[model samples]
Structures are given as C-alpha cells and as structure tokens.
Target: MAEAARLLAQLIAIPSPSGAEGEILAFLEGWLRARGFPVAAFPVPGHPWPNLVVNPQPRPRLLIDVHVDTVPPQGGAGPVGPVERDGMLYGLGSADAKGGLVAVLLAVEALGAGQLADSPITLALTVDEENRGRGAEALARGCRPEMVVAVEPTGLTIGVAEAGTLELALEVRGRAAHGSVVEGGRNAIREALGLLRDLEALPVMRAEHPRIGQGAVTPLFIQGGERALVIPERCLLHLDLRWLPGIPRDRFLQEIAGVLARYPVAWEIVDLSAPFETPEEAPLVQAMARALETVGLPAIQSGMPSWTDAEPFARFGAQAVVFGPGDLSLAHTPAEHIALAEILQAARVFQHLLEAFARP
Candidate 1:
C-alpha cells in the first residue's frame, strides 16, 4: 500500500498534458521493462507518444485500459508538487487517473508472473483521453478482448453502462432587417432560446434508464448579431448531448431532425461517440461483484455520465466497464485529490478480480 502511494506521488509530479506526454512515456517504458513486463509501444502517426502495451497478450482474460495523459493544469505551475494531508493525496492527476494507474500496477505486481502467465492479463496505457480520445479509438481498432476495464475515477463503483455523446453545431438562419422594425425580420437569437427548451422535451429523451437516467441537452454556446443596430441574419448554436445507449445513428439523427423540421435551421453533427451497457448477468460484472463482496465492499452497479474508452470497444463486442478509486467529480479540477485508503482497497479488489479470472 505504501509503495502504491509513492508511485502515485511520482506520477502526479510529472506534467503530461494531452499531446505532450513524451517524458512520462519514456519513464513508464523503462519502469515496466525493469519490472519484467515486456512493453510494446505502437506509434500513432501524428501523436508524439505511442500507446504502451504491457503484457501484450492477445484476447486475454482481463484487459486493463488506462490513460496516462491528463488535462493541462488549470493554474499555478500545473500540480508539480505533491501534498499529502488528512489521508488524501493532493495533485492534479491524482484523482483523474494516476491513482488508478498505480493501483493496477500494484495489483499486477502482487499477482506474480506465474499467476499472470495462467490468466493472460494485458494492460494498455492509452493517451489523449482528455482531448479527442484518439488514443482509445486507435487501441480499440487493433485490439479485442473478452472484457476490458477502464480504470478511471469511479469511486470504486462498478460502472456497467455509459451514456454516449453527440455535439451539434446548428446554424439557425433568419432574415435581416433594421433593429427598429425587427417585427418584419425573424430574430434567430430569440428562436434559438426557444429551441433550447424544446430540445429537452424531445420524444427520444423521454425514455430513461435506471442508472443513466434521462439524457441531457445543454447549450454550450449561442452566438448571433454581428452588429448592434441590425437584426442578425445567422445564429450559431452549439449543443452538447448525453443520450442513452443502443440508439442507431440514423434514428438518432432522424429524431433531431424531427424537432428542427419547423425551423429554417441547417445543422450538422459536429462530434459523436457510441454508448454501451453491459448486462448484469455478464461474467465480467459478476466477477467484479464477487470480488468486491469478498473485500467487504458493496457490489453496486451504476452508469457513467461521461464518455470513456469503453465506448470504442463496444463496437467490437468487448464487455467493458469503468471502475477505480476517487470521485469523478474531482477529475480535471485543480483541487483533485483522492483518499489513500481507497487506492489500497482498489488494488486489493483488482487482485481478487484477477484471481477469479485466472481460475478454471
């Protein structure tokens, strides 16, 4: 446990923002090689750092997905110094995922080479999770495992499902006229305000999942009116979405078009991500639940609101879930910190999970 904490501290001290994770990548490669794990680094065409694959086993029993890159520090030197206070480890990436990363390493180390050989577990450390998730997309394209667990800050809950994301940039067009005689020209900015409220009431959004709940539609930005004295001809509305899983692409777009049919707006899909939910009876969830119960923790199942690497694997029929220590709300914040005990407990949980799969 003490060693795990120490490793997390070291990881937090390094600044590995999205595309510039070179130094940390080098450090991890050497560290894994020294520990007897043969590391395979795959070069991504435009990426400065390659995805590091530890244990390189194909279609293993357990595939651990971890992201090494973090969002840039919000302020003050970028979490360069580590502070331990009140049983919590304080650092930028401490909660986002460096803690989970260290815990996975500790669990594998304790499992020993003999057990790993029998279980055939693989660990893939990806990059660019905070930006575009290109690292995960690339990894998912080349690899397929029976089950993959994304070690994120889940506060130890077994995340069984996750909502997908769809970002839309709509151009709500209107006629231009003098601001004084605005009654003749349509006010697109005013119309956009109405769409914001109407979007939440869409028919597709009425259906709610037990864990993921009803989807969310939030307006990210609204811009209209280039000049002060004239009615704006165009208004741009950027929308952020969190919709339920299993909705087909064509149907999803059709539903959006249903709402915009009345308006003179032209919109396009700006960004999109797939969603997935694992059945409760799946072996992966069962194994995790049994392991958590063995460790005297609740085997609770829930849904993640944010997108994860698991989304990419869903297309390949991989059963994936998000699980780890620390509250996700603290992720990407300047005050990110996680309890030291959670790290130790999470490592123990992971060890039990590995043991369960390693068994016949």
Candidate 2:
C-alpha cells in the first residue's frame, strides 16, 4: 500500500497528456522490467504513442487493460502536482485513471511471474483511450481475449454495462440578408436551435435502461454568424448523444428522419463507441462478484456512465466490464483525487480477481 501510494504520486507527477504518453509508458515498462516482468512494447499504427502488452496468451480467457493517457492538464482547476492530505491524494490524473492503473500494477506484482505463467492472461497498458480508442482497437485486432477487464474509475463496483455514444453533426442552411433588413431571408442559427429542440424532444432520445439509464442528447458545439452586419447563411451544430442498450437503432433513425423532413438541414451520424452489457449471470461477472465478496466488499452491480476501452474489446466478442477506484465525476475537474485506502483496497480486489481466473 505504501509502495502503491508512492508509485501513484510519482505517476501523477509525470505529464501524460493524450497523444503524448510516451514518457509514462516508458516509465511503466521500466518499472515492470525491474520487477522481472516481461513486457511487450507494441507500436500503435498511425500513432505516436505505443502500447505495452504483457504476457500475451492465445485467446486468453482473461485480459486486463488500462489506458496510459490522461486529459491534458488545465490551469487553475486543481493541483497539477501530487498532494496527499487527510487520506486523499489530489493531483492530475489521480482519480480518473492513474490511481486505478497503479492498483492494477500492484495486484500484478503481487501475482508475480511464476503464477501468471500458468494462467491465460494478458495485461495491456494502452494509449489514446481518452480520444480515438485506437490503442484498444489495435490490441483487439490481433489478440482477442475471451473476457476482458478494462480498468477505469468505477468506484470499485462491478460495471455491468455502458451507454453507446454518437456524434451528430448538423448543418442548417438559410439565405443571407442584411442584419437590419425587415425582410431578412432567414437566420441559420435560429433555425438550427429550433431543429435541435425538436430533435432533442424525440421519444427515441428518451429511451431508458435499468443499469445505464435513459438516453441523452446534448449540443456540444456550434458555429455561426460570420459577418458583423449580415444574417448568417449557414450554421453548424454538433450534438452528443448517449443511448442505452436495447434502444432500437432503426426506430431512433426513423424518428430522426421524420423530424429532419421538416427542416432545411443536412446531417451525419458518426458512431463513436458501441454500448456493451455483460450479463450478471456470465462466468466473468460471477467470478468478479466472488472476488468482491472475498475481498470483504459488497458484490454491488452498477454501470459505466462513460465510454471506455471495454467497448473496443467487446467488438471482438470479449465479455468486458469496467471496475476500479476513484470517483469518475472528479475526473478532469478541480477536485480530482482518490482515497488512499481505496487504492490499496482496489489492489486487493484485483489480486483476488486475478487469482480466481488463474485457478485451474
């Protein structure tokens, strides 16, 4: 636990912004090497940062994956340096992932090489999980584990499912006219807002699920009004939509199409990450539940509110779940931090989970 605290502080001290995770990755590989752990450094195609995949197995029954990148640090949000005070460690990337990442490392160290040699396991420290998820995608293409644990901040609960995210880009066109003209053709921004309101009001957008909850649609970006004295001819709007599992894709599309038919708008849908759910009855989930109980923690089932590396692994038919320490809401915020006790406790949980999988 003391070692975990020390290593987590050291990791937080490092600046590992997305797309520039080389230094952190190097440090981690060296740390593992020093412990007699054989690590495989694989270069991610078309990316500067490379992934460190260790203990590769042929269709391994279990794979533990974590991302090395954190969101770029923001000024005046919180302490960029590590601060351990009153049982909490506050710093950049503390709760969001570095805490969980350190916990995984300690658990693996506890398991050691001897026991892992007989187990079908692969541990991947991937990159770009915050952005494109290309790191996870690359790892999935070659080595598809039957079950995967994509480590993220889930407050140590078993995350059974996650919502799928979609990027909706819209362009509303209108005739340009003088800003002060009484006969102004149309204001693209005004039209875009009305269209957005109607789009957000669709019943499909309100689809709900028990674990992950109701679907959501929010406007993320907008650009319009170029000339100072002219009514804009075009307005661009981007919407972020997160939908839960069981929401019929065809129904959602049909509803949107019906709405679009009444507007002068051009739109496109970019699928970001697919929603995934691991049934509680699955062996993988049962094993994790047993681990929690073994570790003296409640076997609570929950859902991941954000996208993660699990989505990519699930594409290859891997039963995936997100579980770790820290409050996800604190991530990328001024209050970002994690409880020191949770760090050690999560390590124990991971150790138990690994041992459960390693058992013959």
Candidate 3:
C-alpha cells in the first residue's frame, strides 16, 4: 500500500500531457534501471517524446500496457491536491491512469522484493492516447506480446471486449446575411439543427458478439456557429459511435450516409477505430480470472464503453483485456480521483497474475 501510494504520487506530480511525455518516460526508465530492469525508449516520429519500454530478465514476455500522457489540463488547472479521505486518494490522474501505472510498477517491485519467479513483463508507457492512439499504434509495429493486459480504469473488472469507435464530423453550410435580412439567407444553424434531428431519429441496429456482447451508439460532441446577429456560414457536429465486432467499417459509414441523406447537409466520416472482441473463455481470460481469484478479488467481466490500445492488440491476434482499478467515469474530469485502496488491490492482483502465469 505504501509503495502504491508513493508511486502514484510520483507519477501525478509530473506533468505529462498527451503530446509531451519525455520527462515522465525518463523518470520511469531511470526508476526501472536502478532496479536492474532493461529499459528502452521508443521514439515517435515528428514528436519529441518517445514511449518507454521496460523489460525485466526472463523469457516469454507478457506486455502490461498503460498510457503515460494525460488529457491536457485545462487552463488555470494546477497541481492535484493529495487528499486522503476514507482511504481514497483524491487527485488528478489518480484514477484515470497514473493509478494503473503505479499499480503495474508496484506489482513488479513486489515480485522483485519477494524473489518470486519473474516472467518478462514489458511495461509500455506511451503518449497521446487521450487525443489519439499513436503511441499504441507505434509500439504495436515493433513489440508483440503473448498476451496484453491493457491497464485501463475498469474498477478492477476483467474487460474482455470494447465496442468500436467512429468519429463523425457533420458540416452544414449556408449563405451568410445580415440579421435584419433573415429570410435572405439560408441559416446553417437551422440546417445543422435539422441534421441533428434526423440523426436522432436514425435507427442504429444493435450488435451481438460471442464475447464482447451487444453494442450501442451515443452522441458525444457538437460545435457550430459564431455570431448571434448574423446567419452563420458553417457548423460542425461530431458524434462517437460504438459498433460491435464483425461490423465492417464500410457498413458503419454507409449507416452514417443513410442518416445524413434525410437532410441537405454535408457530412463525412473523419475517422474510424475498429472494435474488438475476445472470447471470455479464452486461455488468457481464464488465466486472468485465476489470478484475480488468487488475490481474493472476484473475477468479474464487463464490456468497455470507450476505445483503447486493445483494438490494435486484437489486430495482432493477441487476447487483450482492459483490467485495472479506479472508476473510468473519473477520467478527464476536474474532480477526477481514485482510492489508494484500489491501487493497492490492483497491485496485488497483477502480482498474483504475473507469478501464476510466468511459466506459460
């Protein structure tokens, strides 16, 4: 518990925003090196920062992945206050990720302290996951793991699958005119509103997978218009759609087109992140379940609501699951925080898993 708390405090004190994670990586590399772990920093092209990759001695690597960079702090945001209330740690990045990062580190430290059998665990702490998955993508190109345990905030649940992600930018264009001559111009705001109405009415079919379960869609972000008096020339609306596995990217795009066809508005699918599903009964899942049991925690399973590096790992034919402590709901919020107890529990869980799975 003390180790987990110390590591979490060290991680949160460092400011490692999505595009800037060099200092944090350097700290982690140094920390691991002092403990006799071989560490390498994989550089990302066009970005000054690089991902930290640590490998302890032994064969048959198990990659424990966690993102180091956080969503950029808003202006006026200051250092996180470390408050211990009822055994929980209240601070920025305490729950979303830095907690998971500490958990993995402490778990490894525990193994070394106890002289337990160590299987090679590659700790890939990458950057830019909040904005994009470039770090995960870049690392995937070089390192392959027998199994990947993506340390996401899953409240300690074994997350076997995550729904797919699609980024939609709905644009509406109209002639700008004086407010007094309202009828003389086509209002882009009105067109955008109409498009939104149509989108709300569009039927997104439900999806089912053997392990990932059903899929649903939700509207997340919207932006449009500039002036109150003038008819705006343009508006943009963005939506995030979660699709189930086996749903082709083209099919998802087609559905978006079908929705926008109801209105005379310009729309495009700007980006798409493929969804992933791994069988709950797979060997990797069973191993994780057994490990959780050994730590006296129930082996609960659930589906992830957002995207992660798990999708890219699935592309490489590795059974990946999102499992860690903290409530994901706390991610990126001003009041974001996590319990120290949860961090300690996660460390124990990982320790049990790594030791038990060392042979395989």
Q: Which candidate's TM-score is highest?
A: 2
Name the lDDT of candidate 3: 0.76
Report the C-alpha lDDT of model 3 over 208-296, residue by residue, as the tens digit: 66555555555566666675788777777777766777777777668768877766577677668777777888887898898888878
User: Candidate 1, after superposition: displacement of residue 97 in Å?
Assistant: 1.4
State the weakest 10-residue window (summed lDDT) of model 3: 113-122
**At residue 23, what lDDT does model 1 achieve?**
79
Q: For residue 41, what is the lDDT in candidate 3?
A: 74
- Using lDDT as the measure, name the better of candidate 1 and candidate 3: 1
Question: How many clashing pairs does model 3 include?
Answer: 0
Residue 250: error of model 2 in Å? 2.6
Regions of candidate 2 where Cα sits further than 4 Å from its true position: none
Runs with alpha carbons beyond 4 Å of true place in candidate 3: 56-61, 75-79, 113-120, 177-184, 205-221, 226-228
Clashes of 1: 0
Evaluate all candidate structures by whole-model CA lDDT and list the values in order. Answer: 0.84, 0.86, 0.76
| Cα lDDT over the full model 1 | 0.84
TM-score of each: 0.91, 0.95, 0.88
